[model samples]
Target: MASQKIATLVLVLGLLIMPFSIASYAQIPCNTVYNDLYPCLGFVMGGGKVDPACCSGFKTVLGLAKTKTDRQGVCSCLKSLVSDATDGEIKNAAQIPKLCGLNIPYVISRNIDCSK
Candidate 1:
């Protein structure tokens, strides 16, 4: 319950503040990014095989990140999505892209510098 509350707060905060964080330069919306990546939660939060749906979503989200700011906004949304994740969970999450056979331009981590 406590973790759920934290997750909710992080999502809400991200939704509320994401625009200000990347609005000037980002063309993609965090909500869209959120919806696109939600499918990966199962594999990311759990120790299991990655789903094809999650990979499909992953491809879509990565495809949308066309610019530096777009990537930053996507990163910010991803951080919010897994804000309550344990270190192991984050590691699992980070492996999804590679497991899906997709390459990204940024490092996947809880401490990712979205500004970069």
Candidate 2:
């Protein structure tokens, strides 16, 4: 009976931790980019060295890039998105999406300028 109870406890613990573990891993992309790029650019940023918690934060900024009405926040999110991108890709203008306008072309370009 004791052995069975221990097994049950282990299983429950594993189930509880599984989602959190997965979410942490998911944040690796953002974290890696932030750590690498921020130092060179002179901006202080960290997602705890690419652990799972960073991934949860990653989604928030990514979602902001897609549909947030706050234009300034959207521009700020760009640095996070491209922070992990390869060096060659960074210079390529076509690769970056233009967050100008729905129709009239507002051109919110300055907010995302992380380049030196």
Superposed on all Cα atoms, the candidates' RMSDs to the truth, in angstroms, are 3.7, 17.2
TM-score of each: 0.75, 0.25
Cα lDDT tens digits for candidate 1, 1-116: 55864675465556644544333356777767666666776676665999988899889988988888788878887775556666766788889889999997665776877777
Provide the lDDT at 29 for model 2.
Answer: 32
Best by TM-score: 1
Model 1, residue 53: what's the lDDT? 86
Residue 3 in candidate 2 has what lDDT?
61
Deviating ranges (above 4 Å) for candidate 1? 1-25
* Candidate achieving the largest lDDT: 1
RMSD of 2: 17.2
Ten-residue stretch with the least lDDT total in model 2: 39-48
Q: For residue 72, give model 1's deviation from the true position in Å.
A: 1.4
Lowest-scoring 10 consecutive residues by lDDT in candidate 1? Answer: 16-25
Stretches of candidate 2 off by over 4 Å are 1-69, 93-116
